[model samples]
Target: MVLYADPRRLRVSAVAEEVANGCAELAKTFRGPGAFARGDQLVRASLSIVSNIAEACGRGTVPDFRRFLLHARGSTQEVLAQLRLVKPTTEEDRRLVRSLQSRTVLVLKMLNRLYGHPPPDR
Candidate 1:
């Protein structure tokens, strides 16, 4: 049997860590004014996804969890939007954002399945 801990929860903690790391990596390459602001927004949106999921989990209700999942999905879209706004100067930054966006989509799909609905029409 698989042992489950709140901290080990895939949708909550694991994905959160992934987003945090991705954002941190992205933040390191900025070079001028507005860079910190842009980077902070990206990181905050990414972290929001995970934070909302955990918050919903603590509510201990399926509907609440589902609602939070929807919020996380919205935040995912926000990250994607911000990624599009920034022009990646390095191949590494481009690759990292692409990978992060792909994984985020997967997480959104899983959440949709868990919710028993089609992907949120975003």
Candidate 2:
């Protein structure tokens, strides 16, 4: 029981695309022992943020959509933390991380405004 007609659908897709690009950049610098696992986690979590948004938007239930958006927000926070943990040696890597971080913050703000404050459990 989902509606195919919502403006938020397009917005979520665009946000996800941005996140995917950011994750791709991060994946390039992910070498070394511990860097592999950390990078993988970061990439997945970052991608999850955008994916969840889309899925939730299509779920058709108000509460379910809000719950998924909450999950997306949590994933965004996790990506930020992971980005902080990555000690980038190259200037390019630093720049990419900063860009990704900025984009994520913007997405979070948009999500908050779109959904407002959910219930206590969410």
Runs of candidate 2 with Cα error greater than 4 angstroms are: 1-9, 117-122
The 10 consecutive residues of candidate 1 with the worst lDDT sum are 1-10
Residue lDDT tens for model 2, 1-122: 43332435456558756876788678778888887788789889978887887777667667787788889888888887887788778999888888887887887787787567432232
Prediction 1 global C-alpha lDDT: 0.71
Q: Clashes in model 2: which pairs? A: none
Q: Compute the lDDT of residue 18 as modeled in candidate 2.
A: 88
Score every model by TM-score. 0.79, 0.82
lDDT of 2 at 46: 79
Clashes of each: 0, 0
Query: What root-mean-square deviation over C-alphas does model 1 reach?
Result: 6.1
